[model samples]
Target: MQTNYFYRIYLLLVIFVNAGATVDSNEQSNVGVKVFGPGWDNPQLIFPSRYFFVQHFSDKRVVRVEIEGKVGENVAANRKDCRIWTQVFNETNFDFDMIIVRYKLMSDRCSNGVIIKLFDANNELLMKKETSTAIYAEECVCHNLRWNELMNCDQNSEIYNQLFADLRTFNNSKFNFENSLEEMKRRYAPYTKSYSFCHYAIVNNEIYRKCYGEYVGFAQFMDDMLISLASKTRLPNTQLIVNLGDWPLSDTRRGSIAMPVFSWCGSDETFDIVLPTYEITESVLNMQGRVSLDILSIFGRQNGLPFNKKTSKLFWRGRDSNRLRLKLVDLSKKHPKLIDAALTNFFFFRDEIEKYGPSVSYTSFTDFFNYKYQINVDGTVAAYRMPMLMAGTSLLLKPVSKYYEHFYHLLRKNVHYILVDQELDELLPILRHLIRGKQYSAKKDELPASDEEQAAIVHNMRKFVLKYLLPSHIYCYYHKAIVEYSSLLKDGEIKVSKEMQLVYTAKSKKCNCNKNDANKDEL
Candidate 1:
């Protein structure tokens, strides 16, 4: 009885001490632990992780951080993938309240922790925090909070350079955000032009959109993507002018600011920013109620035949968007054994239905991998389905075209895909060479890639898809491009125009930190 009484008294004393203790304000905020790579077998083992928390005050003060780290010297010397940077703000620092992370590369060894130093708006050191770098392996995998694949880290940087090349070239002249927007409105005004463009503003983590014409769910999908991004990290206040049409927008004669588009061509005097098509984004992520092509899903959920098991003949089935597609159908009809090309629907060539129709039955995207060769041709601008085709096990035969997507430049000829002539004059000869292993002369006499070479190309293409074309990478690319565009802005706060309808706002939602604990501690 005496021992029990003492134990009860001790327990009360411990509780009283903890209640009376002054807790740090930062500690009060629930900075959730983020795991980067695959979960460890041992529960006790710490994997690549980042502990993130933010405390938002009524005043709306901000601080941006750039978490930089390096791998071994040997790795750093030979490769551009040596260092990893979370988000890079210029040396000239201003007040930033939120943390935004972008993916780079690192080593597998976690022994050397990353060095973290906080700096104020004036570039003065405010605080220094050291954390283990072990959690940031080179093969570090993350579903969100940025993502990196097993491939070399430099690919991300290279793609970024290509995507923003036009922006950098145009940056020579100081950019006026308000004036450029007005110029875009005038240039593509609904009354003046047949096509319409949409305006979007991300102000203080909220998305606001105004479409001049029917977007056909483009604006909604984009809004969903932005919402997903903002839920993870706070974004800078900026505005975007997006072209909703199939073709790209250009003002080459007048030198207007580049507008973001789904695709572009190499031959055009175009300086437009190429963004991932909503179709591709929807295939990778959720598109709400819309019919998802869900092509990329073949990698996991869908059933697709293996490369060797697939038929040797080339296969293609799509709407008749270009004359080349119609020619392809004719060629397939002539050589039914070697090719199986058909128009699923005749829109552009409805008059020629007698020649190309009746339309063939719809083939599931997953069944695209049932053949050894898949032909990818341009539809409208660039074929948005290229990524989906590449993700499959079959070899992608891409005819040369002026049109290109954001990642089109990264695809190597005879490496990632087989490059055919623009006119496809030698397609039969090339196909015969690949199928029968017999050389045939054409416009330019070239031998078809060997069977081994074909396999290697498919392997390379799939690797590229896993490394760079995942939904996470798509989101990362969008966020990074927006940040770069925001940097070029020379104006103050962008306000919603009278025409734009209010779409979304994060102001209604509270900061994703432990508010109750933080407030209690503050009191």
Candidate 2:
């Protein structure tokens, strides 16, 4: 009796399948049908997919789709070739059927994440798919102006025009910039016009008492020098004054024993006068706040600034303080002139402080240096030498160095920096290296590695990072993780069930004959 019942059910299923063959040209039609299993877990659940359908109306055609998650699959079709394919799945294992309600293809191209749909004979919706995650073979269509190119380009060249053209293209193709631009402008509106600079007042005990009393007087003089220098340099837009340290202490014990210290009792009064001149005018100020004098002193110790044992001990208080000491070893090796300036500024400030008291004093030429320093005329400036000079010179040279590369590139075309033959020989291999690393992509002949092969590739990448890119410690960590995860595949870390492979395949009638001349009997 059980066998007979099973046979009857099978007969009914066959009858239903046959009944789905009827064609009603005028009636609204549904083509594909996808039936879920008992738990509605269709096979091939491990892979991703999407469903879409095309429908025809009296006046126009429409496409409808329901997406399960974020758009994963992309649809690519060539109307001229009458071919269409989903770019997501590497393989599939299910069957489905769908009916076409509309024949007209839409003229406009859909965006990256849209779903395409089709219908079955019973007007039932069918299969769906998403684009693959693998990188595409096509080159990025966007163009960017490199820092060097931006600095060196001719104002009227085709290259300049092309750069702007690419920018416009990107704006038009990728974003609605109108509203975003306004919001960005509003966010940064507050900091549009503020800038500032700092100067230090120094005092040394070695300086005469008269010089010590005149410390505030010297600070004002130094402030005036900075202002004058700014004027000569035509940096009128700058504002702000910082009186960096050596303010008057209540007792001599409060000062460093190794170096002469001058106190400025009227430091606050002198600052008030200097601050107003440096105030921002009707404009927003964007200023980097002052660095602490203590921190400045530490920086000098680390950078191998010339300091006597007594002065170094006074500044660097602990045994491990030498670890904090910076050896100009690197910079000294690269640029001797820079090192020379560093040393000169250190001693210059030290001497100025000892001779002039902790007041403003001259250091170097206007072109070479423009910072104001307070000098203690009685004592040696050597103890506070590194901190004072390093901090001051860094501020002076930073702007020039920041723009140096840009200027260098701009002048390269006008000046011959290297022989043509030497340039070609050096450039050939560098160009080849860049082309291989930056331009190459795995595509066509180079498909994604198979599960078994990926482990070895990951291992090699980790080894390369450790061996060749050793200095880049961060990349080593990242590559190690990549290798471990990739090796999991080789270790049978994942076990996939057979039911997961049963994907739904939609069915549709293939029009073997011409549509216009099809006979009713032939169909």
Candidate 3:
């Protein structure tokens, strides 16, 4: 009995000496202790089915891992063809005949995580790991931005930084005074009846407004945004036009005025200044108004099921806005257990109702978390619910579109959400891989992400929304946009017309009125 016990103890010591601090728990092996949150320097541990192990340490920017074998050449050779965005890992040392991996690449493309692989001389897979990459958290402060940081954010900042080209154009140009309020109004006249829009002027840090066309919730949402901005900082005197239509005014006609719109697509970037969509802003503000809700509570992340408990099917239900939506329903009908999708309305294609009718009931927003993957198809323009959908714990299968919202540039495909082709040809194959960890491709290199990788992607997305999409960040963006737009005024001159009225209401006054008021808006 004593010899048997000693033999078992000797085997354990030998295993420990060979592998060095075995990390088997998935949670601890992926993300470690980083107070600001886990969007940086959290390298993953991937090994074969055998008892292989490694220990890793990371600061804000660099991660160093030690492997207990002479696998330096294998790691170096396989990393290039791993297709995880090249040139991130380097073999630092071969001391004690072991490999030391020094990972120090900082890229927005690798925001989801970095994939590190090792292959033997015969090109057989030995091990693989996916490490989380750094985002703008360390450098960019989402809550507030100093005046100077505006330009700097555009130049060096990653995720959550809004581009300010129009501001730069007007701020840098010395030749001016040719374009005035009348010229802008005349340029805007041709499209007034075609779409919904409004005009506003900020005078002495107060909101004044005039509306040509009305959309049910749009005007009120804009009022709330301006009120939030006015409460935060003193506004520069300026007048601006806003587009409240479902789609951005994409006409880049000669002499067109630069108007702020909720979304823009393709070449519209040259003419339209994009702002956060009203839908996302309204949802965030509504969540903030609740007594028990906090910044991260906007998406009801607490209600989302644990990854293992979530339903393994992809889910979607919405109006048939595009032809692709109808095709999705047809595909869902054929594979009901795999995909739960149906058109709730058929206004766009009423004639086709006979074939794809019997609309499905609308699912509650919170109930969306029951499924593992959520489908996001473009509706009218960019899907207004994208930010909210992405905030949930479930993975998103988002289709490509020409339209984009203010923060669209921050989103990385297969990082924040899985990118499905417009036609969704690879949808089923991708879903099989993510749901069951089953590879569909015949090619040896086109392997599916492991279960840990899928969960890590979801974690990265939720962290992104928590860090950058808070109510404070949205308000700060509005304030910044106003400040940058004010710089365009010639001679710093701004005038209010007779039609414009002060946009003051009980709701507006309640925000930041005084310290004594318990309802003072929280930044």
lDDT of 3 by residue, 1-523 (tens): 4224323433333232321222234543243211111111222211000112222222212233222211234675433322221222222111111122322222212223344444434454334454432111111111122322321223223433444753454455532333533454565555656556667777776678877643424787788666644543456777776766666553446455443433323233445666767766675455423323232333433343455567889999899898888888888988887898888888989999988877878877667777888988887777777767766767888887777777777888767788877788878887877777777684214432664455556655765664456444565566567666666556655566788888843244422222322221211
Per-residue lDDT tens digits for candidate 1, residues 11-30, read 33222112111234243232
Report clash pairs, candidate 1: 48-135, 62-96, 62-97, 63-96, 63-97, 110-134, 113-133
TM-score of each: 0.67, 0.15, 0.63
Alpha carbon lDDT at 235, candidate 1:
72
Winner on TM-score (2 vs 3): 3
lDDT of 2 by residue, 388-417 (tens): 222221121111111111012222210111
TM-score of 2: 0.15
Give the C-alpha miss distance for residue 428 in model 3, angstroms: 2.0
**What local lDDT does model 2 show for residue 293?**
26
Give residue 250's lDDT in candidate 1 (0 to 100). 61
Q: What is the C-alpha local distance difference test score of candidate 3?
A: 0.52
